[model samples]
Target chain A: AQSVTQLDSHVSVSEGTPVLLRCNYSSSYSPSLFWYVQHPNKGLQLLLKYTSAATLVKGINGFEAEFKKSETSFHLTKPSAHMSDAAEYFCVVSVFNDYKLSFGAGTTVTVRA
Target chain B: GAGVSQSPRYKVAKRGQDVALRCDPISGHVSLFWYQQALGQGPEFLTYFQNEAQLDKSGLPSDRFFAERPEGSVSTLKIQRTQQEDSAVYLCASYWREDNNEQFFGPGTRLTVL
Candidate 1:
């Protein structure tokens, strides 16, 4: 079985401040991890993915996450927060056994000026 | 050049009514996927198709949900006798190949069952 856990249900940050959204995963095999963002009523957009090639993955909009095998964690981070960054972020893990992807509940991010 | 597209951006149905949602994948895409997203929740996988073959439907919540892609280009998801619990956004996504990890998602159809 594969599953993802996002530590925060909601995160509020002031503009220009550092942003962090924590996520952890559990999988039996070597997993492919991903981070996606969804704006208000929009569809999901891929932020980045770690397919075992690189432990440090860079994504769109200056966002990035480090895959730590020892910690079982893939946490997204951004140096500075922008108002447009306000959205829901989901951490996902793809099962190597069957190619099915599992998503975490999600973390809602709020950016304040 | 266009991404995945879904029709009936919003649908309001009374309980027990049937509804059909459509999805048009990107040109030449070989894999299509359907997912359901409840309010404030992440999208849950519903089914998957490779070309015209329905490879997986294990994530479907119940038998009431049926999906098909006859010609391998356009697909439809039909929900029969919809219940209030069926109210949610139905999302469609597609990838160039089954082995590809990146998927392009559509805006989705918001289904509301009263």
Candidate 2:
């Protein structure tokens, strides 16, 4: 039983301001975590993944996420928001036993001008 | 060179009609996955295939839903006696066997059972 929980359903941020989307997980083993972004009418694109490697994982488009084991969280962040960053973000977790992936409800990010 | 691809990007069906969706994984990929996504929700796993073998289908909603990847590359998902609750976006993803964890997704087949 692995599960992911995204704290925010929708988040709004100014174009030039910093952005953060929170996510937490519950897994029985050391889990592999991933962040995926999906633009409107488009497929999901991988942002980053943490596979028992680095705790701080950097991804495409200047985005990154920190895997905090003690806190049971993996929150995505970016220094500055861009209009193109507006999309749906999903936090996924895969357990060590199986390749099955568990996904959070998803967080919709809206970049304001 | 191409990513995972799916056919019939959008489809509308009558309540009792039968529909089939197809998927073509990236060349050489060994794993394929099928998921269903409802509005304002995350994708839910329906089935998985390793090569031509249908490995796991524990997430399938009912017996009416069936999937096959007989050739190890191309796959199809069929739904019989469709109901309104079956309306959702059906997503297909693929990954290499050695790297089965990170999957590349297709644009998905949007099915609307009316």
True contacts kept of each: 0.53, 0.74
Chain B TM-score for all candidates, comma-separated:
0.97, 0.96
| lDDT score of residue B102 within candidate 1 | 81
The clash numbers for all candidates, in the given order, read: 0, 0
Model 2: per-residue Cα lDDT over A1-113, one tens digit each:
89999999999999989999999999999999999999987888999999898999999999999999999999999999999999999999998647788989999999999
State the C-alpha lDDT per candidate: 0.93, 0.94
For candidate 1, lDDT tens digit of each residue in B14-99?
A: 99999999999999998899999999888899999989999999999999999999999899999999999999999999988555
TM-score of each: 0.98, 0.98
Give the Cα error of residue B44 in candidate 1, in Å.
0.8
Model 1 segments more than 4 A misplaced? none
lDDT of 1 by residue, A30-88 (tens): 99999999887688899999988889999999999999999999999999999999999
